[model samples]
Target: MPIQPGETIPSMKLTQGTPDGPRETSIDELFGGKTVVLFGVPGAFTPTCSARHLPGFVEHADALKAKGADVVACMAVNDAFVLDAWAKSQGVGDKIVMLADGAAELTKALGLELDLTARGLGVRCQRFALVAKDRKVAHIGVEAPGAFEVSRAEAVLGAL
Candidate 1:
């Protein structure tokens, strides 16, 4: 099963693309002592991910912060370079952090891995979002297969 409300975010190191370069960060470092809104995408540049999911978060980053979110992050199974480029393409700047779970380690740790090997995409993270307060889940929304309602930024903001 996936992570649920009240569960602690798994302790795992993941890469994130920064203007300086790729940096290794752990879940605790990202979520500890903060209210974090983290969203996972199947891939960095896929249709729904690029067109709606990430953009939605970017559009609402300020509102989310205003609502008490200390950090807004977007994670994908892609590498740091790809994620960095995607962040640039999306004009994300410093508004959102781009996390790279290249090997899906954190995804599996969260029990939110979606295997797409048959489709040739290998293993990927599911479309999901979670609100974590001080390293524990306050809310989590995992979308149904091919669906995009529950994990939208608007939905998460309402939860906050």
Candidate 2:
């Protein structure tokens, strides 16, 4: 089943590229005892993801933080290097945490994995955003396929 509001995120390790190097972070380590805004995209550098999905969050990171979000992050089914590059290209590297779900482990665990093999993309994550506090999801906004409505920063911020 898909993860629902109030469900505690499963323990999983994700890769985040930092100036020091690639770091491994667990759900507990990232969201435990913190209010977090986590948004997931199908892939890094994809058209919609690069243009609207990510930029929306990037442009509103400070506003979301001011609304009580301790951390604002973006996750995609790509390697750390690609995610890092995309973050830099978007000019939001410092504002949003770019996480790489190299193996789709986190996406599958959340039941948000979408099979796009016909498009040669293989498995990808659905576009969604979650407001989490202390490792439990407080609110979830899942976008419909090919739609960009709920997961935008303004939408999630309003929920907060």
Candidate 3:
């Protein structure tokens, strides 16, 4: 089932790269004790993702923080290195957490995986965003295919 507003984030491992190497980050670890704004993209560096989705959050990170968001994170189906490079290219800096859902573990757990096999993109995630507080989803928005409405940063800000 798709995750809903009252549900806790799924217990699965996502990844992030540290100077040491890539490592696991549990869903609880990311949303366990804070108000987190988590957004997922189909892939890192894709046109829509790079040009609009991710940048929206980066530009509004401070605004979200001002509205009581403790963390603003962006996740994609790519590995940590690609996510990091995408962040750097967008000048993301420390404004957003670049999460790597390399295995599509978290996306599948949320029932949001999109299989783009015909396009050779393999399994990926749909564009979506949510607010989680102390591990439970408080609000969420999943975009329609090829649409960029409810999942954007402004949508989350209005909810906050």
Candidate 4:
């Protein structure tokens, strides 16, 4: 089952591409003692993800922080290098933290893995967003296939 509200974020290491290089961080390190809004995409630089999903968060990042979010993060199954490049292309800068779940370890831990092997995309994370406070989930929005309503940044802001 997918991770639900009130469940603790599982202990899983995820890589974040930083100016200094790739840094490996655990779930607790990211979400502990913080109000985090984490949104996941199937892959970085994809059509919908690049056009709307990510840009929304980038635009509303300050609003989220104003609403009490300490961290706004974006995660994908792509590698740290690819994520870093994409972040640059999007001009993400320090507005959002880009996480690379190269092996889908964190995605699987959250039970949000989407199988796309037949399409040659391999396994990817489903489109979703969650609000986690102090390492525990307070709200979750898992988008239905081909739909983008609930997981949008606006929705998460409203949830907060």
lDDT of 2 by residue, 1-160 (tens): 6689999889899999665567898888888899999999999989999999999999999999999999998999998889888888889868999889999999999999999999999999999999999989999988888899889999998988
TM-score of each: 0.98, 0.97, 0.95, 0.98
Query: What would you estimate as the lDDT of candidate 2?
Result: 0.91
Kindly provide the TM-score of model 2 when superposed on the true structure, using C-alpha atoms: 0.97
Q: How badly does each model clash, as a count of residue pairs?
A: 0, 0, 0, 0
lDDT of 1 by residue, 10-103 (tens): 8889999988889998888989899999999999889999999999999999999999999999999999989999999999999999999999
lDDT accuracy of residue 44 in candidate 2: 90
C-alpha lDDT of candidate 3 relative to the true structure: 0.89
Ordered by lDDT, highest first, the candidates read 1, 4, 2, 3
With a 3 Å backbone cut-off (N, CA, C), the pairs that clash in candidate 2 are none
Q: Is candidate 2 or 4 superior in lDDT?
A: 4
**Runs with alpha carbons beyond 4 Å of true place in candidate 3:** 18-21
Give the per-residue Cα lDDT of candidate 2 at 82.
90
Alpha carbon lDDT at 85, candidate 2: 83
Tens digits of per-residue lDDT for model 4, 1-160: 8999999998789999776779999888889899999999999989999999999999999999999999999999999999999999988999999999999999999999999999999999999999999989999999999999999999999999
lDDT of each residue in 1-160, candidate 3, tens digit only: 5689998887777897544456778777878889999999999989999999999999999999999999999989999988878887998988998889888988998888999989999999989999999989999999889999999999999988
Give the lDDT of residue 21 in candidate 3: 54
Candidate 4 error regions (>4 Å):
none
Q: Which residue pairs in model 1 clash with each other?
A: none
